[model samples]
Target: MDEQQCWEIIEAARDDAGQAWDHLDERLEHTLTRHLVKLSPPEVARFAEFFRALQHRVNREDLFMAAFLIHHGCDDDGFGDFRAGLVGLGRDWYTRALQDPDVLAEHPAVRARADISALMLAGFRYAPERALEELTGEEYDGYYDSGEPVRLDDPPPQAAPVPRRLEKLAALFPRQQAYLRELYPQLTE
Candidate 1:
């Protein structure tokens, strides 16, 4: 690990207070962007918006946010933080719709989702929902079409579900409970 990562892990793994200060400078996400590839101009702006929305739900401390980001984005592809990009785009949609509920109220399909959580594990795969063949309705028409295949994987891929993703991450790292208790007293209860 690099100097910054080690220091960050040490500090970030501390109590919530430490994490807040450490991350306050955006250091919490420095390593986050380090591994991130880049996305299109639009995708980058979109994900920034999504990450902003998730900032509110960042309770339960780092694990929740980490898990969410890792689960959603954290892909080492050229466009880093793939999930963040999509969710950001989705958040923009949500905010726009909130200001004008009737815009999508007439649309049956777009009515039933929040946070772009539903967008993961799909062909859109957070590339650009509006650009994707499946999800976009009126939005797809006359957009700059980038027919790039976002993956180097086999033609058909099956990604894990959200719950399974959480379990999987916990299992892989398997941080000790006692350590967690030391870091977060509330975890013991």
Candidate 2:
């Protein structure tokens, strides 16, 4: 979809509430994903750069928390805040998320789960050093074999702090917390 069409969908969703909002949000995400898949290599590179730049400005923890909320059906105020954050960042973030939903996997909550983490890592062209640090040297090698220069024996990087908002959201949604714990026992610790 063109930029104008994308914005129009976003604008419509911004004012919508209840089921309408959910439908619109899904529609917006679908369109953005479609657009992302159709981009040329140069366009993909530009989008990736734009995504990285925007990532620096936003609370990535919050974004991941928002993704969890959206994923688990917590679509009230939290969804609104998450949607606003995406809209504020413009279409690039949407495109980036479509390109690599694992971008959200940077959050510790996401990393705690092996299945989710694996899926996220698969989206990445380059192995995320922090994510793989916990793995054995053999495990890392098995996961990614680009043959590029990388040190597998180094210590895993320190984890990023989980944002207060993410914590609060988790606390507020006990079901989500339970779901996470069920899938990833480490999250409860």
Candidate 3:
């Protein structure tokens, strides 16, 4: 499926959950899987491709730094989960975040410091694969040919320069830094 179609599926899942951030991991996975199961296997596979591609789009150091500050120090796995959770926020929020990671400071979940990891929306990261498995009675291996590397555990080689210190990250994302301070009043620049 194309990017727009991919977003529609996620948006539908968000709507299915009444746009509430609570228990979104289970809710989004169920809704997204329900939508994917109705499609042909190839469509499901294509959706997986697009999903990974979109995740890849946000695999940058700036976003990683934003996640680190928001989540209180992000590792590789945390960054991956954070990216998936960002996608789960829907297209408009995702695009705005792409333009300015600082905008995340205004997000309700971020303001509440909710865990934006596998427990949030990353369970649906593999929803298309799960749907394919259910439909074809076999595990999905369609992601191998998406032309993107499968090393979600590894930072991308072309990732932008990550600030080496919290002070630098704070300087780069002043708005987010302010929000972070609000979350952790003891934190200092």
Residue range 48-114, candidate 2, lDDT tens digits: 3333333333334444544564356433444444434445334544445434433544433334542
Clashes of 3: 0
Per-residue C-alpha lDDT of model 3 across residues 1-189, encoded as one tens digit per residue: 677788888899878966666778888888899998999887887778778877878877667767867765667887888888888888888777776666777777766656544223567777877888888888655442545443333233343343323554465457766765565454332
Worst 10 residues of 2 by lDDT: 118-127
Model 1: CA > 4 A from native? 1-47, 62-175
- lDDT for predicted candidate 3 compared with the true structure: 0.70
Q: Please provide TM-scores, in order, for all candidate models, with all chains considered together.
A: 0.22, 0.31, 0.74
lDDT of each: 0.30, 0.39, 0.70
| Residue-level lDDT tens digits of model 1 in 31-109 | 3333222334344334333333332222223233233332332223312232332322344443332333223322222
Q: What TM-score does candidate 3 reach?
A: 0.74
Q: Which of 1 and 3 is the better model by lDDT?
A: 3
Query: Quick one: ranking by TM-score, best first?
Result: 3, 2, 1
Error of 1 at 102 (Å): 36
